[model samples]
Target: MAKITAAEVNKLRKSTGAGMMDCKNALVEADGDFDKAVEILRKKGQKVAAKRADRESSEGAVIAKVNDSNAKGVIVSLNCETDFVAKNEKFVELANDIAELALNCNSKEELLDAELNGLKVSEKLIEQTGVIGEKIEIGDFRTLEAPFVGSYIHAGNKIATLVGLSAQVEGAETAAKDVAMQAAAMNPVALDEAGVDQETIDKEIEIAKDQLRAEGKPEEMLENIAKGKLKRFFKDNTLVNQDFIKDSKQSVAQYVKSVNKDLTIVGFERVALS
Candidate 1:
């Protein structure tokens, strides 16, 4: 058996980001073959990943990245098993890197299959799971493309938002930013009443009517009361109807109009740790 020198162990550790003992063990197992030792370490990572396949990764980092032209953006959550690993500098960097790649990817699957330093993102994640001794993976991913895009990553990286606008106006960027922050705060269900699906609208109306009927309202009055309640629901739950965070006196739609007459939200995406 070839002796595993400290120099070889340290070299493998630097190359693979594995623990010293693991690297030494791999080197010894591979009979001091550098490539074989690296492969062994990766196999160990794969085993760890498989074992933790059912583990829930609820904590990590959220990252949002926009293109140089501001016409496209991407947001993603890189998750881990613990807050300690979530706050690691390297973990955050991994999230940022994946988000940057997501700017060009149309879907989460594509982003995972994307390559990083000759290794697919999914493979890198498994490798990271092994290095960190926990389940690490991308929890969510979304992208926005429009005439203008604005993105925000809230404090602690627990939340991220991306807003798309129909027109690129002078103040459109600021309006987009305000709307993104609004999304982070309010968690709106839809952009407007029109965007609310028929199923959800019907469900809300039914729920409202049931409550009104249970309160002894007349059957004839129940429909009208439910309609009124639905309107209130729209006002409170829709993005455009919700009061602006900065100025509660006006709706988000009114605030956007004040910024630029033609600027309007085309689409938006929000991701949270939970």
Candidate 2:
């Protein structure tokens, strides 16, 4: 049997982010062969991942990152089984690193296949499951691209948002960030009235009609009254039409226009842990 030194154990622990004891055990099991020890730890991760396949991983970090030019951004949620693991400094760091990598990828599938520290993200998540002793996975992956982009992450990493603008104006960063914060706080259902799906529109109208009927509104006026209520829904639930949280006197669209007449909110993406 090969004698495992403390240096060997620390090296494996550093490389795998596994606990010192786990690394030492893997090293011992592998007869002090570093490569074999890594394999053993990875196999442990696979076993843990498969065993916890049905576990709920609703708690994690929501991270947002943008490219150097600020023309593109992404929000990624690195989910774990508990808030304790989610808030771990190393876990959040991994999430931020993955978010940075995600800024270059178009979709979750691509991001998973992308390599991080010589390991594919999907593999890293599996490895982390063993290290964390909990399910670790990506819950949300969203991207936005425009002439300019900005992002915001709410306290506790509960919410993350990205906003894109029509042009890279003077205040584009500030405008985009403000809109992103608005998205995080207001939780708009759609970017605009036009963006709201017909199904949702119908449902809101139907709900309004029922409420009005309960109030004993004349049945003949139901259609018009429902339309009015739908308009109100648009005003409150859509990003551009919603009242600006900072200044209730104006809508989000107006606030963006005030920054620069040519600046417009082209798109946005939001991701939350819940």
Best by TM-score: 2
Residue ranges of candidate 2 with Cα displaced over 4 Å: none
Q: Which residue pairs collide in model 2, if any?
A: none
- Model 1 agreement with the true structure over 7-122: per-residue lDDT tens digits: 99998887777889999899989999999998898888899999999999999999999999999999989999999998988889888988888888999899999998668999
Candidate 1: segments with Cα more than 4 A from true spot? 1-11
Clashes of each: 0, 0
lDDT (C-alpha, whole model) for all candidates = 0.90, 0.94
Best by lDDT: 2
TM-score of each: 0.93, 0.98
**lDDT score, candidate 1:** 0.90
Candidate 2 least-lDDT 10 residues: 260-269
